[model samples]
Target: MFLLSTILYDKNHVLQNNILTTLRHVLSNITMAKNEKHSVKLRIWFYSGENKVLGKGRIELLERIKETGSISSAAKGMKMSYRQAWQMVEEMNEFSKLPLVEKQLGGKSGGGTKVTEAGERAIIAFHTLENKVNAFTVKEAEKLKF
Candidate 1:
């Protein structure tokens, strides 16, 4: 009776360990499946010779400037320094055929910045290109196995 009881206890212990091991394997596979999925990341930049003329950050800055009508306000909204924002606008203006941002003189209502017609066109064109490129990337990403 004593030998039989000892054998039964050992068997139960082994069974518990095997069940635990299987559960761990299943959980690990589930975790891996969740984490192993892949996607494509792409960044688009328009350049002039060696200088970068436009990109996602610049586009956001332009949109913010258009919305807020002030370079300083736009910079603040984006958590960037006013000087940096000013430099970007200057570079964009210098690179483009026409000025992207224009400054208005102070008046009764106070002076502010404005996005020119050309700037509006540039913003739209960039967005259109970005969408097309993103679609292409997504379609290509689906073909990747690992």
Candidate 2:
């Protein structure tokens, strides 16, 4: 009876060890799968004299302004304050050679804003450069070792 009990204990110990090894193997595979499927995001911003000229966030603001036709409306749509949106527009206008946005005075018809030709051009150029940089980064990521 004693020998039979010792044999049963050894079988149970081996079974537990096998189960633990299988669990470890599964967890490591899951971790490796996660590590293998990853992406790189590139945010490109241009600056001049310690001031930001153009960046992803600013570009989104510009697009929002163009879409909404009012800085306040754009701000509301983005869940930002009117003052913050106005400040960003001011900074962009100050930095650029041409004013990117033009505001009309409020009257019976109400005031509205529009993006200048230069603003449109700037948006296009920014997106073009951004796309190029993102493509380059993706290629670089593909070449990464370890």
TM, every model: 0.72, 0.71
Candidate 1 residue pairs in backbone clash: none
lDDT string, candidate 2, 70-93, tens digits: 888988988988898889888988
- Tell me how far candidate 2 lies from the true structure as C-alpha RMSD in angstroms: 10.1
Best of the candidates, TM-score: 1
Lowest summed lDDT window (length 10), candidate 2: 1-10
| Candidate 2 accuracy as TM-score | 0.71
So what's the TM-score on candidate 1? 0.72
Model 2, position 128: C-alpha lDDT score: 95
Deviation (Å) of 143 in candidate 1: 1.8
Query: Model 2 Cα displacement at 141 (Å)?
Result: 1.5
